[model samples]
Target: MNHLDHGTEVNPIKSNTKSIITDHNKDDHNAQEVKAIVRGPIPAAAVPDHMWQAVIANDRAYDGQFFYGVTSTRIFCRPSCKSRPPKKEHVFIFQHAEQALQAEFRPCKRCKPTGVRLPEQEWIDIVKTYIDDHYASPVTLNTLADISHSSPYHLQRTFKRLMGISPNAYVQEVRIQHAKERLRGTKESIADIGAKVGMDNVSYFVTLFKQKTGMTPSAYRENKASNTMNDVCTPD
Candidate 1:
């Protein structure tokens, strides 16, 4: 008994003609003709159900197999991206990293889906630079992510993890510090000083100032004024 390891077994054909179709016949040669098949990696459309579930679970095993992007946010990530999972309906699957890039989706900073890696501290430093430059303007998580090339979710997570403060809190601290400078150096009205430091609402500014420094903006200004006077009155 002989057993073949590969290739398909061909069936014998019984024809009405006088010739018999056997392994030695031309018909057997036609049956043995093999068609070459070239197969590439499976596309997203053909991804298995288990693979999709792995993405939801953030299983690292599927990291290189596929990528997913949130259509609403336009950000792509590896299967094991640490960021919170987007709604399934908004997720668009990619066969590979390049496919996500071709769709104009930014790679997630946390996952390094696009292979462009920036250190965690470097990202935090970029965010700090943005905060320092835009402290006087409106600052939001989205704005920080836009300037730092990261997702708002990732930015907030990394900023909190590394800096021990939320982005919004950091911005408020910067604004309050700027307000302090304006209050001490200039004789401007408290409201104007609040406005100068990006706090348009004077009441809110006063409340924040008191919460942070235990003194109202007016009290801080008066205290500075008194200290200046004492400096002039006292002997050098």
Candidate 2:
């Protein structure tokens, strides 16, 4: 397997603080929604000069959905900040934190543009909100980080450090746990349970259920039924 296949952000160019900036801004998602949803490393793209000026202006009239990647530091932001403007040569507009990281631009400790600095408690709480809202849909840490103006690496690190597991893992655990509950509490088929949990690979779902609970999903259902029956027969 290509070592690069693993989950870290992918940077095509070695870190080039000066040269990463370029002209031309076109992304498919810009027209689709008020907010962007990203799930992987930021793609390399061209950015125009006027866009930077628009950001410094914080022209809410100008769509900010794709403009805040630099809001946490020197690269992005309104032209209106009290501090002096960034050198034209050193500035580049990133659409997301993964883009900045791929370009090797460290977050401004002062601005900390990404929502990554949120306390673990707050981070988990927000993640729960995301899950509640989008659990049935296809979503990933990259998507969640996109909501926070940061990269998957930043969010994953903070989430793991605080929650003791990767965000993706926590999501999977939550999904599987929910699936198990439905399987035991309802007459839903194994396939329905899997689908309800955002899983479609019936075989893989069964395997995961077995791995996590030491029993097939069907067996788990049977166990739950038997327990209910025994409880009903016994007092209270």
Candidate 3:
């Protein structure tokens, strides 16, 4: 057989076929990439005006259709939640409760949007723990209610029903217990101790201390010192 010339030109048909096959492969790759993007998580739906209206109306008809989260409170609720309607700016719409939760919003205790209600006792315990940690700050019924994501009246009633006292009472109790600890452990003045425990009014602090412990702060401090001295002097 005669040898082919080294300068022989590439076949136009074969060259064109190779280019078409390469382009086809690229197109297939691009299509696959687009499909992967489409298969990624769908974004939450935007809140429409009607959704806001539904929320304002407390329309139970829209309950499972969507959930709304309040940015200020970081709480999500069903559309029918009886709690006050949040400002439109503070609201975010989520198609599913899981999406809201994933966005770091807690389910509303009152609305129970997660289909599971938080037990009253557990909710009160959470409130109580918050008080225990923040008792040095100004704690009020409305503050506790907001932090607990319940209406003030409902929180007051449920807290009392479950804990045997109002939220404010529990806050006072926590403050007083801390005051007692500081009284026993430190020589800080009674007024300073009261202020440290969130009771800035010395007279009120003294009176409330008396009401709770049957003695003024001064008396309590003195009593603690006397007991300490007695303990130090007594034989073990």
How do the candidates rank by lDDT, highest first? 3, 1, 2
- Pitting candidate 1 against candidate 3, the one with the higher TM-score is 3
- The true-versus-predicted C-alpha distance at residue 172 of model 2, in Å, is 1.1
- TM-score against native, each model: 0.53, 0.52, 0.61
Q: For model 1, what is the C-alpha lDDT against the true structure?
A: 0.75
Clashing pairs in 3: none
Model 2: CA > 4 A from native:
1-120
Q: For residue 27, what is the lDDT in candidate 3? A: 62
Worst 10 residues of 1 by lDDT: 31-40
| CA lDDT scores, all candidates in order | 0.75, 0.60, 0.81
Find the candidate with the highest lDDT and give its number.
3
Against the true structure, candidate 2 has what lDDT? 0.60
Candidate 1 runs further than 4 Å off: 1-114
Task: Give one digit per residue, the lDDT tens place, for model 2 in 4-86.
Answer: 55577656574453344431123323333223332332222434445556545644444434433332232333223223444
State the lDDT at 84 in candidate 3.
Answer: 77
Best by TM-score: 3
The positional error of residue 57 in candidate 1, measured at the CA in angstroms, is 30
Q: Tens digits of per-residue lDDT for model 1 on 1-236?
A: 99767886544453423355443466344323211110223334554566567677888765665677776556678878766766666677776778777787667777788789757886687678778887878888988876555688888999999999999999999999999899888889988988888888999999999999999999998998999999999986
